[model samples]
Target chain A: MKLWHSFLKEMKLSARGFYFYVEILVAVIILVMILFVVPENFRSVEDEYLFYDWPEGVFEEFVLPTLMEDDLDGKIESVEVEGDDILYPAQLIESEGTRYYIFESEEAVLRLTDLDRPKIGAIIRMDEQSQPYYEYYLQGYETQRLRNVYSIFHILDFDLMEAEFESQEVRSLTDGYLELSDRENIVPAMLTFNGSMMGVFIIAAYIFLDKQSGIIKAYAITASSVWQYLMSKVLVVLVSTILSTVIIVVPIMRLQPNYGILFVLLLASGLFSSTLGLVVASFYRNMMQAFGILYFLMIGLMLPAIAYFTPSWNPAWVQWIPTYPLIQAFKETILVNGDIGYVAWVSLGFFIASGILFVFANARYKKTLVS
Target chain B: MIKVSNLYHSYNKDEHYAVKDVSFEVEEGEIFGFLGPSGAGKSTTQNIMTGLLQLQKGNVTVAGYDVKTISNKMFNQIGMSFEESNVYSKLSAKENLEFYRKLFDVETRDPMELLRLVGLHDKADIRAGEFSKGMKHRLTFARSMINNPTLWFLDEPTTGLDPAIASEIKGIIREQNKKGVTIFLTTHNMYIADELCDRVAFIVDGELLLIDSPRNLKLQYGDKLVEVEYIKEGETIKESFSTIQKEDLDKLQEVIGKYEIQTMHTKEATLEEIFIKVTGRELV
Candidate 1:
């Protein structure tokens, strides 16, 4: 009952300070940007592949057989001879109702390329070790996920040929990016970065304001425990995060994502961030003194967004950040073929982290709060 | 109601102590004033007794609870009005009191009643941030009484108020004491201490000089003297005569008989003078 009272007081305090209204404004702005400003599919229809082979028969030997083995059904319908002795004619390969133009050299590929088609070029080359490697030329408009898909496909093909293996089938871990549009794919990033993690900054600011106003000293002499005080602030932060999350998620995702799991993930993330803010706020006397640590932590939390947008750049350290799994969990809820087990594990980790941080924060506040 | 024995506190956790070997006790329903200048460790001692500061090297028991192991039940019986006005600026005066009243598990006084007691009944709806310093301090004082605490810690309650408001605050403190509340008032204001305290302790440089009733201290340390003003030879003359000195008393009588006396009054030593005499330091 005391916690509930404290929560109500906190809400009133936050509301009076215009924090509540500011969050609503932020949510509205983000919703408009996501729903209207961002395009549905960043990848255009002309964003097909154009294979370029350097030495005479690299495509015929390394690429053709791989495409045929994968049941790609690649067939050369016509070959246009350019009347050049050294360079072979461009071969038009058709498979699965799509056309792939294979060129002999870089110069010929550039010359024959249609300016209207926004094709991503795949240049094949032989390394000094006699192994085939690919260098992709991308159009400016392709998303990082699409670029990653191209790289992964070629790298796997070359690795298979070197291993003398016959595993031609490409198995995906999830239903893959095909299930989400470019605009929908960005929702998880926004939810984790702008929605759930809002608690870290907001809660720290609240603590600093209270400290400057000497409210914490007044509270220390009261009957309320430190945990109750911290939990009340955490609850306030969760309300803000939930408001922003619903505002962003409902319009774009609607019933597509599991509302229960999404809210659970948000709760975990919000609690974790709020407790972290409390622990950090306890060490410093005021916000100006704590700006260095706050900025560092905020930047560190945002590091995961880089890895989230670019799926192929998964460094070991970046993956170790707490927000990494949180963003991934948000994505899992939005997509149909998501890994529920992974989401469960990430949510558990967040909850445990929040518990440990809460303990540390509680101890710090109790010892140094009134000093 | 509050007891401290051999209390020592070091801000740096070293030998440089802010409070050293301090000990005192307040009886139930008594107003005990901790008198000291700035940085004299009066606040340190009070903080230790109220469980605001950790008991570094001594024992403290307030309302029968060890301060080192003070629980929520003890806090329910204790209220502290800080030196500065510490309140949520965004909350109204009534809201601030209401918010704090809910923190206690015991039965609490109505917020409106407390506000009215502090003479802030009409400004109850005003935000604390917009309040003047004295108004905020009054609000803080009112908040301290919301829990109906038996053991109240008041730090400089009337330090910066005007004469009228200060007098009102002193009256409220007196009224609360009459209701059997034990007040641990810490301040450097000697006049307030002399007027409101049942007993005042003089402390300086992290050490207590003496603790006694105001009348007892005055009688022990003050000189017995009288100042006389009279017209002699068409000229007003002023003189002081020591009551203990026979020759001075004789001269005073002769002057009184010879010239029409304008005024004569016994001079009593103030608490400020006694404080300086006892501690050899002036209260700021």
Candidate 2:
């Protein structure tokens, strides 16, 4: 009952201070951006590749037929150009909203890619077998998925090979996982970044504010134990983060995402973040003394987002970051077909870490109250 | 109700101490004042006694609970009013009291009644952040009484309050004392200590100099003197004579017989003067 009142008091404080409203506003803004601003699908770059063949007829044989077979022939066009149109080369020429770019030579291809765009260039030559063996030039920043699509599109043969293709079977390792659109893929990132980490910032600021106003000193002589104070704050932040996650998820994802696992994952993440805030805030006297270190920790927490967006850049060290597994778990639950085993393991790890940190933070706070 | 023996607190855990070898006691239902200058270890001793500061090298107990082993149950029997206003600024006055009242396991006073005692009954709905400093102080004082504590610890409760509010607070303290509440008041205000304390301890430089009732201290340290103002040869003359000195008394009689006496009055030392005489330092 005492814990419940403490939680209610914290809720009242957050509501009256506008911290709760600000979080809701942030969730709503993210929802609006995801719903309207971000595109549903990033158009596949199959025809966006710029090609230059030595014999100059490889486009007609390999590319044109593939475009024609895919019923995307109207989207591609060949153009011949000379003069200063050569000086300022466009990666993709637009004519009536159609992609039409001419590759004059390997020099022109290099010039087009020199503008720092991710364009794939193919150099076709005749092998000793009298068949074409191609040398491909690629901008280093292209995603693994984009590179795979480029290889699959350009490797099609005149010999249909329908029998070989029919022999291949696709299967998923997880039971309920579904393919996520580009728009849906960002839901987990938003949830982990905005929803879970919000408490890390709020709790620290709240602690500093309480310290400045001498509220903790007043509370020290009260009958409430330090554990009650710490748990009440963590629970409040957990509720807030769950509310934000629901606001962002239900509008766009509806029932497709696993709400149970998602909420558990967020509860663990919010607990970890709030405890971290408590521990860090205990070291400083007020917000001004803590501002720099707080921002530095926030930026450190954000490092995992880089590995989230670029799956190919996964380093062994990044997996050690607490939020890395949290992001992965959120993605798993939000994408619905995510590996339950991985999510469960990550959630367990967070719960254990949060427990340890919470104990340490409680000790630190006890010392802080006296000082 | 409160006891301290060989209490020693060091900020750096070194030989240098903030509170050194302090010892005192407050009997049940008595108002004991701790009088000292700033940084004289008054707050440090009070903190240790109330379990705010850890018992580093001391034996202290409040209401039968050792400071080293104090529990939440012990806190239910204690109330503390800090020198500074520390109520939650975002919470209304009533809400602040209500929230604090929930922390106690024992029966508590009504929030409205406590607010009324502090003269903040009408502003109960207003947020504490919007209150003046005196109002916030009063609110803090009201919060301390919410638990109906048996052993009350008040630290400069009326330091920033106006005379009217300060008197009201003193009245509440006296009323609580009348109901068998033992108060440990720490303050540098000599007037309040003199008016309210059954006995006040004089401490300076982390050392206790003396502990006695205000009247006893005055009688012991004060010079029982009388000043006489008289007109002699058209020049106003003023002289002070020790009433206990026979020679001065004879001179006083001679002056009364030889000159036109303008005025005469007895002069007694105040508690502030006694504190200075005891500690050789001002209570700044």
Candidate 3:
């Protein structure tokens, strides 16, 4: 009815097309709510393998035997612990004709007896590989008591007597990595796909709606200048883009509760991607032309959006592309740690350049309206 | 208030001038009609005068601002209702008026009062675009007065209206003229021009062939003498003479007194006939 009210009215009119996006977001949010609060939601984190720091030969000596690799091992005939846990270690000696072996958790080095020769090797859990000591009194011998005590790695503990072997004390610990050890390095790939690409669906939907409805010519006569109007539309599209980006990447970064940072990153990405859509949509007469141009433009975007599909594969010349700043900004703060200082400037640059692109798009599109 | 000199324009990207060598003046407080058939430069000339199109070779001054250099400020001083309906499709008739009411410096016009004036008050809540073409035209006519602009441009402003409604619009245009607003209208309806315009310009192929007050044009083109025919005893006789001449008036009285004068009256060419004779084209 009034100017501001009428502006809001037009905004509401324009927002009809956003219903599909709302549906998508509601569905995703429902899934996330179910998954987050619901138990045993197995989104099977892909199987992973990684190499870690270890003492020399420890992996082979301890780990290889558990894998069923046979090895000739000496017997622990005697043991001693003079000071503390290290006061005694079972001394190992090769057996002449006897054939038996022992490895166990929490056995004193001095208690082993009978000097049974190890068959080839005995499976000792990683937790019990070290010698134990108590009161500085220690000795070694073979024990026939097989008490099936399983340690952290689930390998059987064995107490064997050998003249040359050493005793050890090891409390089992659950093996875990502080930072997820990604041997295949999959995160950057996912980040790249999400960065400049998150707005593609919104862009496609926007052009299609405009084409289907006969509103484009009505837009041609608005009192607002072409640039301001286009920028406003970009702002509207950016709202959706930012919302979609947060919906997509927040849980991925495991930061559903981090609304502040999520908003910041989403706003940055939306401004960037919506501008990209505007620039691409400039050459289109309708929806089909928009998507056709989008594919070609994305090739250029992907070339520099290298950080998305292949971060390590970035060409030396990627920074020259227009989309590079947006990709760099999104990936730096959102995908990588919140490197806000580095990304903030890039985000600002993206916004300013996006503003310029909007002006250019307005000029280009105003010509199309006349046609 | 609206004047053009050697106005020339074409599609900026393409070949020829849509309006070529068009020049006219619409004096303040006059309804100057631009009459032409389709494909004539009537619309193009109107667009230039209204500052809707860029003039490459002409200087158009409306309400004292050059159409090119002062296009922005000039828009506020002008109100337009083109051949196409430009009202918002989603808004009711009342809502459409109110939407544009704030765009001008003038006091906001009461939407209800305006709709009632246009006989659209009963349909005030109906979407203006969904209304019949005649109703939309009336609403458009109402919309043009929203700004209370000093200069008004109406292009084929009453195309789809019934005769009764069309005459009502003509009356409203007269009222607007009496309020001292300059109206530059384009229409092919000679009845409209003959009834409403104080003066009219006949434009054809981007050229102004004739410009005069409609009353003056008809008087200039019509025969000055009156023709009469009467029936005698199984025979018919006719007489022709000027009414303005003193002796001719006395002879008409004598003839009526002498025999049964079946018909005796003055004759004048209609505006449509005059337009055809001047432009070699029918109004339709």
Question: Order of candidates by DockQ, top first?
Answer: 2, 1, 3
Sort the candidates on TM-score, descending order: 2, 1, 3
Query: What DockQ does each candidate score versus the true complex, computed on alpha carbons?
Result: 0.59, 0.79, 0.08
Which has the higher TM-score value, candidate number 1 or candidate number 2?
A: 2
Higher-TM-score candidate among 2 and 3?
A: 2
lDDT tens readout by residue for model 3, A198-314: 465455455445534434433333233445445555555555555554554555556512345445655665666666676676565566667667777667666764454565667
TM-scores for all candidates: the values are: 0.82, 0.88, 0.65
Q: Write the per-residue lDDT of candidate 3 for residues B139-164, one digit (tens) a residue.
A: 87787777677888888877888888
Best by DockQ: 2
lDDT of 2 by residue, A218-307 (tens): 888899998898888888788889889889999999988878888778888988888988888889888788889889887887788899
DockQ of 3: 0.08
Off by more than 4 A, model 1: A44-178
Identify the superior model by TM-score, candidate 1 or candidate 3: 1
Please list the C-alpha lDDT of all candidates, in the order they appear: 0.85, 0.84, 0.61
Isolated chain B TM-score per model: 0.97, 0.93, 0.90
| Span of ten consecutive residues with least summed lDDT in model 3 chain A | A44-53
Poorest stretch of ten by lDDT in candidate 2 chain A: A89-98
> lDDT of model 2 at residue A301?
78
DockQ of 1: 0.59
lDDT of 1 by residue, B90-161 (tens): 889999998988899899999999988889999999999999999999999999998999988999999789
Off by over 4 Å in 3: A1-6, A15-232, A242-307, A310-328, A361-371, B12-15, B223-230, B234-265
Worst 10 residues of 3 chain B by lDDT: B68-77
